[model samples]
Target: MSNGNNRQVIRAEIKYPILAIVVLAAIFAFTSFALGYDQGQLFSIVVGDRAYEENFLHELFHDTRHALGFPCH
Candidate 1:
């Protein structure tokens, strides 16, 4: 019936906004961690302990981290 169709439409519309919010939140968390907290631990899974020594992400985001007051050094 018409009511069922409307309910389906409402559910569909709600799903998209919820999905968008979840996706955006995930992106924000990832960016925040990468720029503010990452210090090679993420890359270490592939590169081994050398990543910790090299600190690739930390070096890459060095200036931004300092600007954001993350205290890299």
Candidate 2:
């Protein structure tokens, strides 16, 4: 019963790859742009130039943009 060697091994089960981090960062940046700086640009892709004139997104995020300190005017 007098053994001098006893050891325990530990392993981590979670892993984060560079690709996952990059994808998350991209999503965050896109969301920020949409909510803070979007002036109908995103909707313009589907609705054409009219989106800019309508300024739907701008109005939708207007109060939020101001609260978050984004220049809407």
Candidate 3:
């Protein structure tokens, strides 16, 4: 009795061709640009959260307060 249960299975494979390379490269470049752009939006959202608290201009207020050595309550 021969059981072929234990065998190496290739989960994924890329075909070798000029068009394949071009298509993959285009996708990679597009994804890079899209991710970078989206990351900028994400950063702005996080910064905005930090920049506003208790009805204050939290970001600018921080700089001015620290520069003038004003007490932070």
Candidate 4:
């Protein structure tokens, strides 16, 4: 790969995964405590924003998934 292509891939492999972890951690933590242990409520709150929530959900579900042994979009 050319230098620019290599750099782009490297950056994507690092940045999106990290962002996914942070977001997932925040999601878990908030669902665990900040929302009084109510997962459904938390889900509701998160989904309440409708458009914003759906977009976030898309980013979460598709682009930046869990930070595990997998690739994120």
Best by lDDT: 2
Q: What TM-score quantifies how close candidate 3 is to the native fold?
A: 0.31
Residues 17-72 of candidate 2 have per-residue lDDT tens digits of 99999999999999999999988899999999999999998899899999999988
Candidate 3 lDDT at 1 equals: 67
**Error at 15, model 3, angstroms:** 7.6
lDDT of 3 by residue, 45-73 (tens): 55764333432333435555556665544
TM-score of every model?
Answer: 0.72, 0.75, 0.31, 0.26
Local distance difference test, candidate 4: 0.48
Q: Model 3 Cα displacement at 70 (Å)? A: 35
Candidate 4 per-residue lDDT over residues 1-73, each given as its tens digit: 4666555334444446788899999989864442232223335654564644444433544422343323433
Which residue window of length 10 is worst by lDDT in model 3? Answer: 34-43
Better of 1 and 3 by lDDT: 1
Ranking by TM-score: 2, 1, 3, 4
How large an RMSD does model 2 have? 4.8
User: Which residue pairs collide in model 1, if any?
Assistant: none
Taking the candidates one at a time, how many backbone clashes does each contain?
Answer: 0, 0, 0, 0
**Candidate 2 positional error at 70, Å:** 0.7
Error of 1 at 41 (Å): 0.9
